[model samples]
Structures are given as structure tokens and as C-alpha cells.
Target: MSKQAVALTLTDLNADTPCCPPIAQRRIPAESAAVLAPAFKALGDPVRLQLMSMIASAPDGEICVCDLTPAFELSGPTISHHLKTLRDAGLVDSDRRGTWVYYRARPTIMRQLAALLTVEAT
Candidate 1:
């Protein structure tokens, strides 16, 4: 391939203008580490991680709180609190349909997290 064509992919990948270089290449910047740290922090708890997976892998992209509560041995309020934490972190969305509240993973942030963690060898 031509030199110009060869450079295009690198340019396109760096187009986002990330503060840190790629994860495989260099240490992630403290600034970026700060921004994404919460996401990882939010997932640190086992209950929260399972909640995320349940929401992300749910059929129809959503699951009811009614269903989520029973799956865990915790109280309704505890599960609700965890769900709220995920919602506040911009990881999930909740909507009340009649009597029950349903939650779904936010795909935009999911994609961004996936892209950020993606390691493309130079």
C-alpha cells in the first residue's frame, strides 16, 4: 500500500484524540484513568457486576426489577440501590411500565468502554 494509505488507519484510530496512548502501548493517563475509574469501581462489587451482566445480556434489551430482585438473595431496597448506582453511573437506564420498573444497559457507553479497552497492535 502507498505511504498515505498506510497512515490513514493510524490517523483514523487516533482521531478521537485520546489523552493516553493505546493500552497495549503505554500507561493510561491519570486523567483518563480518573474518568474511567468509576466504571471499573462500579463493577467492583459482585452484585453490581451480576446486575450489569443481567441487564446487558437480557433478552429484548431490558429486564424488570421484579425479576432482578428475586434472582438475588438481597432485599428489594438493596437491589434497588445497586440498580440506582448503575443508573447514576450512566451504565443503565430505567423506566417504569405500569407497576414494574425495567432496566437496560446503555449501549453507547458500553461501546465506548469496549473501544477504549480494545487493544490494536501497532
Candidate 2:
């Protein structure tokens, strides 16, 4: 299946539980780790982490780039760069509407990250 198809399929799964066994129970393949590493790296910055949270938790399910920029001390272009990084990492999707871009979280990746981090009680 295509990567987009796989992402959609994974998002349809139960959210209360993980789709894969936790990291403690199974090792992550090098390929999978490589794929996920960018997402982790994108979130390593406090600005990017806050940006992701803002995008993910937006009441309308998406937020305009205009709205996102004012929340930070950085310049608009800097914020755009961070958003581009998030886009490159596949953690968020963006749509440009006329002059502004809107961003929304990609649930599939969020779920994948959550699944990997979940620690089941012993």
C-alpha cells in the first residue's frame, strides 16, 4: 500500500490502545527508526513542540499560519521554516488558502509516536 493509504488505515484504528506493541515489548527496526527520527527531531525544539501542540489542539482542527506566528517571539519567516520542518517530518499537513496557510496535525503519525511511547503497567 502507498504511504498515504497506510497512514489513513492506521488512523482508523482504536485510539485508546496502540496499534503496535510498545517499545519495551518489541524492538524498532532501523528503517522504522529512521522514518520516525525526523518527527522526533522536529519536535525537539521548544518552539516546534509548542507549534505542534497549538496546531494539534486547535478548536477548529486547523490553525492559520497568521494565528500561529503571533504566539511566538520569532519572525514570521522563522515560524514558517519551523512549520515547513513539521511538514517535512509528516507530523502536520498544510493547505495554502490565498495568502495564508493553515496547518493540521496528521493523526497517523501522532498515533504512531504515542504507540511507541506507551508504557504498559507491569
Q: Which number leads on TM-score? A: 2
Worst 10 residues of 1 by lDDT: 5-14
Residue pairs with backbone atoms closer than 3 Å in model 1 (clashes) = none
How well does each candidate superpose onto the true structure, as a TM-score?
Answer: 0.75, 0.82
Report the error of model 1 at residue 3, Å: 33
CA lDDT of 118 in candidate 1?
A: 75
Q: Count the backbone clashes (under 3 Å) in each candidate.
A: 0, 0
Compare the candidates by lDDT and give the number of the best one. 2
Tens digit per residue, CA lDDT, model 2, 44-88: 999999999999999999999999999999999999999999888
Model 1, 3-77: lDDT tens digits are 353343233223445424546667765555655666667787999999999999999999999989999999999
- Global CA lDDT computed for model 1: 0.75
The TM-score of predicted model 1 comes to 0.75
